[model samples]
Target: MDIFSNLWLGASTAFMPMNLFYGFIGCLLGTAIGVLPGLGPTATIAMLLPITFGLPPESALIMLAGIFYGAQYGGSTTAILINLPGESSSVVTAIDGYQMARNGRAGAALATAALGSFFAGTVATILLAVAAPPLAAVALNFGPAEYFSLMVLGLVASVALASGSLLKAFAMIVFGLILGTVGTDVESGTPRYVFDIPELYDGLNFVAVSMGIFGICEILRNLEGEHERSVGVKRVTGLMLTRQDIKRIIAPVLRGTALGSFLGILPGGGAMLASFASYAMEKRISPNRAEFGKGAIEGVAAPESANNAGAQTSFIPMLTLGIPGNPVMALMVGAMIIQGITPGPNVISDEPALFWGMIVSMWSGNLMLVILNLPLIGLWVKMLTVPYHLLFPAIIGFCCIGAYSINNSVFDVFVMAGFSVIGFALSKMRFEPAPLLLGFILGPMLEENLRRAMLISQGDPSIFVRSPLSLSLLIFAVVVLALVLSPSISRKREEAFTE
Candidate 1:
């Protein structure tokens, strides 16, 4: 009943004409980016953050949330049509989806993806509504010591789950933390790394930093391998699934939704991980296992469902605990900060209309994707035909403009350009940028909480251990790190990423 009331409040806000318009625009942009290969939701959002400054917080967040999930719907289009995954999570979708297109079952593959994603998104949204309140309630009880421990667990879990070398991930996290220390010290007005520059006193703008690292850096990388992709698909038909096709996909969709929901709650676990894991699981146990890479509908169904479910559930920790599970969520945290709203447990109580409205808006956004995508398939396919050489220049120009708009200063633009160079160098070294972004976002919070806990204990180091909740969190983080280092688990982790 309370949930229903909250949802009613949300409906009043989400269904407002202005909010619906914003959500539609967000879905439209999200689909466009998802259909275009070199563009992604993270970079798109980072570039657009400054533009949302004048909008109400609820409208801004709802629009951003729409983009995140809408991309899941749009990414499948390229996977099935051209065999080029528009987003990383769609990589598995291409395996069977492209084969289906080659076999002239492209329409069936696309339909399965749409239906599976819709079901999964709905389930995950409901799960978020039910689970978030209790989690926030638990978080509300946390003190400085517990909050610090929770952050420690988040950073460690991010490292354990990140793909590639553990040492590199640690190095990136440390580097990000170092970058975070550049601003004026909050407790003492002394500047740590400002170097006499006035702009450095306030710290680097995250919007500019993210724009350079993700948006500009991506443009640079794409330029090195720039080439036009031919659209192999001309026309599609037979979108309605047969009874036999429906029967085969039911179990796989259910399994994927459950698996993705669980994994999404873990730090560093998101759509890409869920899609790969679900596809692998279906391959082992699906009755149509032999048909996995041969245009099997089950293959298309499971990964699509898992990815959408994972995308939705990944918001849980970000909204409830102020811990971002991935780079996209980190950007969302940045958006909230830009809106002058603190993200965490108190958000639900202090801003019920905004919180509930955003949740309700996700469902509406998913519906808009389904209603809009099928009819707009032709437009999306045509977008893929646009050349990268022409596309990259426009993107770089927009990123530069966006960076300069942050504070109406050219310094931020320079920061963005400098970070782009740094990001490119890191990519060349095979270091994952995700951990670095997470570390940068969490570093100051971690430092603040640690200092507060120390002050409360009068500088006694044993205060962290004295709190049972804090001790448990620390123990859990250590165990996770230990498991990641263990030989068998390490091998499995590598295999998961490689596959």
Candidate 2:
């Protein structure tokens, strides 16, 4: 089959010494951050994005992908050990996992999390390989009108699924779009909002902006409420699972993988949402539901599987249509642009090795995580004892160096600092920053496509409606908005998020 040959090609590239090393490094750093409660993958990746500009596309992306999913593995460790979830997706894991630990089944709970995540990640990677080509093929048919409509659909879906007030999400999106307009106009070759600054001509550097908002801003928030955690976990043993334990986890793992794979393709639906949804579903339908909050192994298996699967499959839309489903993926899109490779359908045909290589690297990365994480559990636990006051300064220093390296200019450092204040202010106002990042990333593309469609139609807006595909996409966006607005669905959404 064509898939076999493609995978063989991917394997060759993924197995290279340098790529493997980077993947290992990424997994290591991801686990370290995941063990530290305040640092999420989004901030970690944004902080490291500028450094990747020098790497080969395959190596850089493979490493980033490893960091993303490896966090899922690491988060479960702290959840089971200390009742503190290293990542948001692991929040539900902490409930039952800590209970299991308290009951002295810490090793079993951890093994379940590790094994479940590996199985889910493997299945999701296979699904990605089988699914991405066709999706990219379909996307290849999109013209400017269709592309514009698709972007609208993505933005609308993002808003519909974003946590917090819809009005605030909408406002952030508009503000991001406005920020995207700061650079020179592509068509007219005129500066719009440069304010006569030479560095502003290229607009705000995405890496700087992202680092400011995610990396530095997170540090600021964490410092405000900083407190040292005292970890007192007992030594873990009994790593092997019984036959009954295996049987109990089988169905939950399968269900979690399926649900996560599907939801991961949706805009704004990533590991955090998938894990929560899966845990909720299992609590309702699981045969051992009565034991849910009292150290249920099913609770450990299902959500860990779902979160890992969701993390992997969330790459679908990003790789196929060049549309990022979440903030992490948006940062990835920015990375691709920095590497001089456009993220889109053409990637498959134009750069098969890089694309397939990244795909294959994910499977290898999963294997590495399983091998690396189990033995490193003690090391990770030790890492958690490092106080925030000691760790945060190093992070801040790295961010500053990365920002300045963008153009070898001090201006970017200033930009990052400025945006950190803005991001902090936005956080104080309770506005979610995910949609804003998505809007900033998609804004220019949306504007370009809209203008091209208008040019083709000689300014006739009917061009969008004349194409059935475009019309359908627009209609779907409207329906999504309508569904989110309905009272019953709104109540359900609130409940789902609250849980």
Candidate 3:
């Protein structure tokens, strides 16, 4: 089918009464959770995975996608009002958004974040539609060798873009490779690392690992820092933009959208990287550079727009090639697997309704977020007042339920609690959990593809270099590794990611 026909099919499915309602519910729940400190889309989606088991694939995906993008919009509310960044992507937003609020421009900052995000989401949705199909078409030509090379490039790119120590990220990737081996080998039917435990024959549960690392560990961290956060302004005034405000933001928003759309398509580059890059670029080239940390509207507009755009476009690789660009997309992968859908290039042809419907739901979710955030700003602010002591118990209880529901086994809950301790320790050591997740998600796929490539070549290592596409991908991976480890480039990466 042509593009228009595809969109029509998607619209019809997405706008069905039930699907639309689920999308709205996801946005509502996503916004509520994202406005709370320490709970981002990764945690939100991981905790909600089991609930989608009873729904149809299309409906389940529509809701999951809604939660991912809606959290991007919700995170700005906390950043602007209370100077607390609810998501890592919103950290830059807090620098200027909070300053604007302190200067009695709270309403304007919130409005800028909402409107800019809506505009960026609209653009990125279009990009996703135009870019994904062609990419998938190209991917249809891949052999096992090519697929293996692509996974290598993806893993290397993730390590390059990961925050903090490069060596540590590499270590995490190796560790994940080891963890991924803890199940029965597909070829040999023999357990590799299960230690004779039947429950682990399928490997560690995805829900258990994600919830413990993202949800339970985050809750533990937040509990230790309980305090009453103050809102800079009790009353938000003048939400509507003036001619001057509109003139100042137009270019920055467009530039940010472009940068974000590009970055979101790269491995490990999602809303967080896009926001940081946009902020850095704006600081260097913006006309109001001197006013950046002092309540500049451009600071609030650029990163907020960039992050939303990145969030939407990051779906491209996941849908087209079964590659997750970041941890949030990784959780979406888990959800898709739960629904018995394998993520790959063929999904567009095999599950067009699910693919197109998810694309359509992004636009609807963004629209819902704009409407919900603009008039109901005070409600989100009020939610921030709930004490931690009353909140964490519910979070832990829900995580426990999610872990157990994955397999109807209490062992999964124990596994989750164990990982929470590991996750907490890693967080304390300043290691980013995202690369570990990327490694974990890609490890099995990498091993399978590599084995296939080897068998096809009859044990010839030259098969990887003999194919032009495979050779090119490996060359690209080498280039990325060099750039990531270079002294000057590594220094710049550190500076860019500094909070």
Candidate 4:
């Protein structure tokens, strides 16, 4: 009852004319970018975060989250029509979807993807509303030691995110923690690594680092060569799925939705896992599993459903626990921090409108995407034709403007440029920069909580293990480490991400 009441309050805010407008724009932008091959939500969100600086936090988050899931909706179109996956989760969809297109069923493939995603997204929204409150309640009971241990668990889980070496990811996180320590010490008020520069006292600018790693470096990567791809849009006979097609997809859709909703709440690659796992499971259960790599609709239905559900539910940790599950959520965390709001268990009580409105907007945005994407599919396809050389310049301009506007300081611009090179170097070394952003974002909190735990225990080292909850979290972290290092899961994990 209370959840419903809170949702009602959220709907009132999210459905306000201006908030609805932001949600629509975000969905439109997300779909446009998703239709563009070689682009993803992380880069788009990082680039557009500056635009949301002046908006209300509720509207801003609504837009960002909308963009995130909207990409899923549009990714299928490209995957089906062009044999190219615009979103990571759309990879499996391409295996069957593009074949269907080649076989003159592009409409069927696209329609199945849209409908399946809608159904799964709706189910996952309800699940999120139901699951989030209990999770938040549990998080509220966590002591400083518990929080510290939880963060350690999060960092450890992120190490599993690396498609390559675990050691490299671990090194990147430690490097990020070092970057996080640049600001003044919260406890002593003494600067830790400021290099006597006043600008460094407040810590490295997150936007700068994020933009460098995700935005500017991406632009530089794009400029490296003149490779090009074209989107081919097939004329569709109808948008309607036949009765037999619906009957065939119903079971796979349900199963994928269930799988995705469960996996989506976990930290580290939940959406990606959901999509890949759904495809693998459907292949195992389908009567025509031999037809998988061809034009099997089950392949399209299952992974699309799972990916949408997963994207919708991935908001749990960031909203409830203050830990980002993926890079997109990390950008969301940075946006919230920039807006002078802290994310975590208290966000629901402290900023209920922002918390619940974002949830309601997700549902709204999903509906909007369904209506907008179907009729405007042509426009999204046309979007893929724009030249990258032109796009990168505009992105660079926006990045500079965004970084400079944060403090109206040129110093931030220089920092961003410097980090751009670092980001480029890290990319060359095959290091994943996302975990570092998580570390940088969580670093100060990690230190603060560790100190608080120590002070509360009168400097006893055993305080972390003394509390049952903290100890449990540490044990979970170890389990996560074991899972990461296990030869079997490691091979599967690599195979899953090979797309």
- Which of the predicted structures, 1 or 3, would earn the higher lDDT when compared with the native? 1
- TM-score, cand. 2: 0.99
Against the unseen true structure, what C-alpha lDDT does each candidate score?
0.90, 0.90, 0.88, 0.86
Query: Model 4, residue 192: displacement in angstroms?
Result: 2.6
List, in order, the clash count of every candidate structure: 0, 0, 0, 0
* Candidate 1 local lDDT, residue 270: 84
CA-only RMSD, every prediction: 1.0, 1.0, 1.4, 1.5
lDDT at position 9, candidate 4: 92
**lDDT of candidate 2 vs native?**
0.90
Instruction: Evaluate model 1: give its lDDT.
Output: 0.90
lDDT of 4: 0.86
For candidate 1, report its TM-score.
Answer: 0.98
lDDT of 4 at 393: 80
Which ranges in model 4 have alpha carbons more than 4 Å from their true place? none
Candidate 2 lDDT tens digits, 19-112? 9999888888788788886889999999888888899998999889888988888888888898989998999999899999889888899889
Question: Over the stretch 1-499, how does candidate 3's per-residue lDDT look in tens digits?
Answer: 5899999989999999999999998999888877886677888898898888889998888898888888888888889888888888999999999999998898999999999999999999989988999999999899989988998888789878878788888887777777777788888888888888899999988889989989999888887876766665566778898889999999999989999988888988989999999999999999999999999999999999999999889899899999887888888887888789888898999999888888888998899999999999888888887766777888889999988988999999999998899889998988778777877887888888889999999999899999999999999999999998899998999988994
Question: What would the per-residue lDDT of candidate 4 be over residues 253-278, giving only the tens digit for each residue?
Answer: 99999999887877775667789989
In angstroms, what RMSD does candidate 2 have relative to the true structure? 1.0
lDDT of 3 at 167: 84
